[model samples]
Target: MQIDPRGPRFAAVLTSAVLAASLITDSGVLLAVQALVFALGAAGRSPYSLLFRAVVRPRLAPPAELEDARPPRFAQCVGLAFALFGLLGHLTGTAWLALAATGLALAAAFLNAAFDYCLGCEFYLLLHRARPRPGT
Candidate 1:
């Protein structure tokens, strides 16, 4: 499926806010909520993206280009992994680990939101390129 490239960036903005709040308040529950969002996104049903479509997109002009959904879905999976790691740290009483993992997630979200640079998407592309092909 193709998606408006802006949708993921919008989601990233919201994600950055949520992750930052989770880190600042040290709220495991909040982080868990974000994890759920990541899970949903990975499954191709991102709430943030839905919100963007319903609420935000209507107000703006149409996107210049659409993107394949797979990369963003993979990016969501990566976010889910980091969020789970952070949640584990919270559960295990490892403050540094929790903060570090959450911080890393926030950094990536911020990058996407601010710079349109999705590290996870780039990684997905890299891995996609590296996979063996049938005729290689």
Candidate 2:
């Protein structure tokens, strides 16, 4: 299966944008933007594909089957958590916490990009292994 790298790239961009925007404007709004972007990705609205085509490389090789599974395993979880944390911070007007979550998200996204070792992919694999296959 082809592992689209666009999600991670968009994540990185969203994180960076939110983080930077947080520094200048309202952190809460930035966090909201990040959350919206993530939600879009999770919806599989073809936004991921568009992002991959627009920003990521065109000649990227296909990914391993195990790596191209679900879109909501680990990375999505982490992203959701981060966005939630940011929302918490936003609600409480806690700039520091929002900044922290955004920073961490950015770091994770970059790591995934550099290593192709998606923490989310690990989560999906773990779930897949734990489950009983059909007719098992």
Those runs of model 1 whose alpha carbons end farther than 4 Å from true positions after fitting are none
lDDT of 1 by residue, 58-97 (tens): 9999989899999999999999999999999999999998
Q: Candidate 2, residues 28-132: lDDT per residue as tens digits?
A: 777676677667666554355466666665565553332352644346666768877878877888878876877676666666656655666676778779999
Q: Pick the candidate with the highest lDDT.
A: 1
For all candidates in order, the CA lDDT equals 0.97, 0.63
| Model 1 lDDT, full chain set | 0.97
Error of 2 at 86 (Å): 1.0
How far in Å is the alpha carbon of 49 misplaced in model 2?
3.3
TM-score of each: 0.98, 0.66
Q: What TM-score quantifies how close candidate 2 is to the native fold?
A: 0.66
